[model samples]
Target: MSERREHAEPFPDGSHGDLRADCERCFALCCVAPAFAASADFAIDKPAGQACPNLRQDFRCGIHRDLRKRGFSGCTVFDCFGAGQKVSQVTFGGQDWRRAPRTAKQMFEVFAVMRQLHELLWYLSEALTLQPARPLHGELRLALDEIERLTLDSPGALLGLNLAAHRQGVSDLLLRVSELVRAEVRGSKKDRKKDRRGADLIGADLRGADLRGANLRGAYLIGADLRGADLRLADLIGADFRNADLRGADLTGSIFLIQSQLDAAKGDAGTRLPPSLTHPAHWSPGDRKVGPVVGA
Candidate 1:
């Protein structure tokens, strides 16, 4: 007997809404613009604005099979959410660095900007699908509209912007969305953060948790609710924050958290940030002032 019970989608977010893993439309933009250092995540040294040596004429990885052995785990982690292709085809109108040498640098800049905006859109779009966040559905829709507009701008316009403020605004709206969604997930509870050093909290409701100065070393925190949690002065060394909701967590004073963990967390506007991470234009922490957006 075949089990035909009511079936639900195995993947919740619709595979990033069909954007990631679709690099054919892109002209391998990420492989060109972002530089990589020879680390566990990269096989070679690449410059920020230069094309990767491994990028072939057809824009495919040359040593793709041996990527892990060669040390490019970081490259594998980056997903463009179809923004690469959109910028390459729609924004730039099929122009490429190989063909239009004069427009190469400008094209690369547009790709970078569109990638960030599209990433925001992907998350917002996912937020729209969550049932409990209905209270903030209207806000999510508005954010999605704004984010999509930015994503579809002409290449020239995208390159001319310093959207740190724009990101901040969107992040603010996203925080409210997360809170509403959390209500159904956690009920009417403080959901305080706990030290619980070695607890088996596979799917704990840690929203608004006060985990400041806590030690979560080697903790398995996958898919945990870290929204609005105070993680200041916390030690998160070796913690697995993969797919965790850090929408509004404060990690400004957190200790021992390298870039790898931050990159894994799903953070938004309410997330009190560290200088190591990108900041919105409006937030000017103690001594470090944000400089102009672009570089010549």
Candidate 2:
């Protein structure tokens, strides 16, 4: 299945959202602008300005179907958060970097900036949908609008933007939202002191643990055994899920969980997911647990 589902209705009112990647309308900026190192994730080392070896004249990956077999599994997990298309069509006025050599450097620079802004938009959009965060909805909407405005700025203005400062402010707001929502989980006595933002959790045996409303932002959960873990309403914004075992886990109401994160992790068909997320094509089939929202 494609990473982006067309006209995906993610809003509470069942309206369609525009924060999805439409590759057909893009200039394949992600294939050209980002650098990749020679590792298990990528077959070759590519410098920042150089195009990937697998990138074709039409800007499609030469081995898209067999990316994992060819050691390019990293590509499967990477999501530009629709920034590639926004930068290609809006910021650069539909002009391609290869066709317009003079604007190539500037286009790449602006693309990096736009990617960060789009990620912020993704988080802000999700935060607005949470009922418990109603108090901060006005502030969240304002931040989303301000970030959207910055994405429309000229290449020079985008390059000069202090994105780190903006991200810090947004992160703070999201942390507060997490507290408001997770606090309301009935019968959930999960430890509040265990909230670790960006902690190294490699190979953690947290199977069957109750992680409801936990702030696991940026936690390194690579290879963590999380089978049957209750992750309802947890804030997993920037969690590193590579190789994490999520078989039979119920993540129905998890916040800030995205397709890219799922793609990086390991799971089975039985792994319960939110309505907005699709099961990864690589998962094994089994009778997994479904979240509380379903069949309630």
Candidate 3:
């Protein structure tokens, strides 16, 4: 179990505190906290709070090397946002749930809450770095501090946290940041149509589209032809990117896009990502080669 979270993008300049998953300090909370169905994502069904069948006694995945081959492809894309380590080491004081069965339920519940808080931290950290969002830096800093504080609270305090309320407040600020960033995009009148927020564009033919600063929030872009599309500064929060062809697409400076969104899409070396994100290792050259741009 490597101490790396798939969704935890590093701070661009290494100035901010770490949010990356440190599995070395974790007790495999992700393998036990969340429930999984015997579907395309998992080989077998496991209820919440139950240890995964592949979990070893030492809190490591028995099939970590070949998880995708064994029908756990979804696990490869999942990120706990450093919640596992925080729960195991800090919150529980290095006490393993197996050694303290009485605290297992509360531990799992708190782990879930911590994961949410950590996720908010991940996005907030990125939002604070955006040049267009400089005006909201103070608000972002406050939100980050509050969320980080919550993550350090006792298990009971975490369980009692109003997660929904906090998320809503942060979300409103993020929306404002998106609007400011997108408004700065200079494009022709035809390019203005690319602002398709919450559009049902599943499998749309958007090849070579100049979608700079588009409001693509919550858009269903599964299997969309995004080859070489310019998505810089686009608000991609909640956008469905499964099976989307991102080969050669420029996502530089995109806002609120998470690693899970990239993991679900097809991209290659030609895909340009933000400074904080690393390209998915699973993507291969054969998945989606760079093709000719229809309108460049």
- lDDT score, candidate 2, position 182: 75
Query: Would you estimate the TM-scores of all the predictions?
Result: 0.62, 0.92, 0.89
User: Candidate 3, which segments miss by more than 4 Å at Cα?
Assistant: 1-9, 186-192, 286-296
Report the C-alpha displacement of residue 165, candidate 1, in angstroms: 1.5
lDDT per residue as tens, model 1, 41-109: 576888887878877999888866655456665664465657777877888888877888888888888
Best by lDDT: 3
lDDT of 2 by residue, 24-87 (tens): 7777777778898999878889899788888888878788888888888888788777888888
TM-score preference between candidates 2 and 3, better one = 2
The candidates, ranked best first by TM-score, are 2, 3, 1
> Per-residue lDDT tens digits of candidate 3, residues 1-296?
33233433356577444467778788888888889999876889999999998899998899898887888877877777778888999999999899999999999999898988988898888888777789999999999998888888999999999999998998898888888777777466865877788999899998888888888989999989999998887889989998899988988778888777888788888887775666677776543322222222
lDDT of 2 at 10: 52
Which candidate leads the pack in TM-score? 2
Give residue 280's lDDT in candidate 2 (0 to 100). Answer: 77
TM-score winner between 1 and 2, please give it.
2
